[model samples]
Target: MDELVRWLGVQLDADKARAAQWHDLECSIHEHQEGGLLKAVAALEVYGEVPGAVCDCGGPARVLREIDAGRQLLALHLPTPYQDEGDRWPGCTTCSWRDEMDDLQVRYPCKTVRLLALPYADRPGYREEWRP
Candidate 1:
């Protein structure tokens, strides 16, 4: 559990960093005087926003919010190093939706708590492999 939580935190940081880098690259390309101009404009385009998780709809899904599953909430409040890992269950709401008949469809994490919960290094970027 602890390992999973730590890995998740690392993943979150990596995701944010990747997003920032992408925005910076885009801004450099457009060379706008005002700040965040590219971000605002790119938000309207597909693949403009950095993907948090793989979505079924083929679009980037964000972490959105942490879903409390029992004791996980308490773990989230823990201090940096001692905090329990893999407490928050991640889900994708962006690509998930209900059908005309109201049948809801959603995507779950690709692996179980024990597997994905294991500690791992942050993935630098899509082009690069995972590193410590």
Candidate 2:
């Protein structure tokens, strides 16, 4: 079995016209609507200063970057999945746990990254009212 499959995230074009629709799709795909795992898409931006202070990862921030449209933007893949089977996944950045949220937020800004609940069997595994 492919190992990265469990840590996969898709980067789709963000359509201004279909922002909500794309988000719904993102929720379906990245969150592993099937039985794989959660995925994420991030838009890269370059700034002179830190976006915000994160609980120092015991080291300096790992400034990562990705290329799009022939331009390099600073971004990194979120190390977590966003869905689960039987409504329970493993790991903090990968599970649907309340405490897991803090782990992600500290590294990836909540506003910049989104959590989609794509589950297997063509069903979404997210709760709109649930905040974690």
Most accurate candidate by TM-score: 1
Off by over 4 Å in 2: 1-75, 80-109, 115-123, 129-132
Tens-digit per-residue lDDT, 1-132, candidate 1: 243445566665655555544422233222222454533323224335565422232121222232223125424333233212443433322334456975444322222332333333334321112211
Q: Give the per-residue lDDT digits (tens) of candidate 2, residues 21-44.
A: 332212221222225654442211
Among the numbered candidates, top lDDT falls to: 1
- Report the poorest 10 consecutive residues by lDDT, candidate 2: 58-67
User: Taking the candidates one at a time, how many backbone clashes does each contain?
Assistant: 4, 9
Q: What is the C-alpha lDDT of each candidate?
A: 0.35, 0.27
Cα error, residue 2 of model 1, in Å, equals 0.4
Off by over 4 Å in 1: 24-132
The true-versus-predicted C-alpha distance at residue 92 of model 2, in Å, is 12
TM-score of every model versus the real structure:
0.24, 0.16
Error of 1 at 88 (Å): 20
- Candidate 2 has a TM-score of 0.16
Clashing pairs in model 1, backbone N/Cα/C closer than 3 A: 4-86, 4-117, 5-85, 5-86
